[model samples]
Target: MEGETKLFTREELKCRCKRDDAVLIIHNEVYDVTKFLADHPGGEEVLLEKAGQDASEPFEDVSHSSDARALMKKYKIGELVECDRVQTKNSFSPNWNNDQSQEQGKCVIG
Candidate 1:
C-alpha cells in the first residue's frame, strides 16, 4: 500500500544472513546492512556476528554516537512483524529519582 510500512518475520530475516546479504534487528527495526559491510568502522565481522538476529543489546551497549545512529537510517529497510517484536530500551522511560531530598549535600567545595 501507499502509506504502509514494510514488516518482516524472524524466519525471513534469518534467511538473509550471508556476507552478500545481511539483515539485522535493532530496537524492533530491520536494517539491511549488506552494502555497509565493508565500510563499517567496526569492521564487517562485528555486524556479521549479529546478522539475522536481534542486536539491540550489543548495539545499545556500545552507546553509538549520534552520528553513528543517524547513519543507521540509511540502512533501515523495515520493522519486525508485530508478533516478532520485543520490548526495547527505547520503548520506555527510566524512572529517575525526583526527590529534592536526594539532591541535598552532594556537592563539596574544597
Candidate 2:
C-alpha cells in the first residue's frame, strides 16, 4: 500500500480544527496544515478560520500563484471519503470573469 491514499470522514476532520491540529478541506482533498500555520503568507488566522470545513469556495476565491498551489501538495494527508465529497470549483483556474452582470451594482470608474 505504498501509494494508497487514506480517506477521512467529515467528523474526523472536524475534530482537528484546533490551532495545534488544523486540518483543511479544499477541492475534496484533506490537508494537515498545522505545521504550516506560521509559514502561511495570508496569516494563520485565514487558515484557522476555515479549519475542519470545506474551504473550496474561499480557497478558490483568491488568485493563488502556481507555486502556492504546488506547495499545498506537501501538506496533503488524504481525501474526503466518497460520501463527503462534493464537486469543487477549479482552484487552479478560477473563473473570475464568468459573470460580469453580478457586478451591476458596483460603481465602475472605468
Question: What digit string (tens of lDDT, one per residue) describes model 2 on residues 12-36?
Answer: 6777888999999987799999999
Q: Best candidate, TM-score-wise?
A: 1
Would you estimate the TM-scores of all the predictions? 0.78, 0.77
The per-residue C-alpha lDDT of model 1 at residue 36 equals: 97
Give the Å shift of residue 22 in candidate 1. Answer: 0.4
Quick one: how many clashes does candidate 2 have? 0
Misplaced by over 4 Å in model 1 are: 93-110
- 1-110 in candidate 1: lDDT tens per residue? 24777888776777788999999898889999999999999899989999988788889888899999999999999987776665554455365343324221222222
Q: When superposed on Cα atoms, how far off is each prediction in RMSD?
A: 13.6, 10.9
Cα RMSD, model 2:
10.9
Evaluate residue 61 in candidate 1 and report its C-alpha lDDT on the 0 to 100 scale.
86
lDDT agreement with native, every candidate: 0.79, 0.79
Candidate 1 clashing pairs, residues 3+ apart or interchain: none
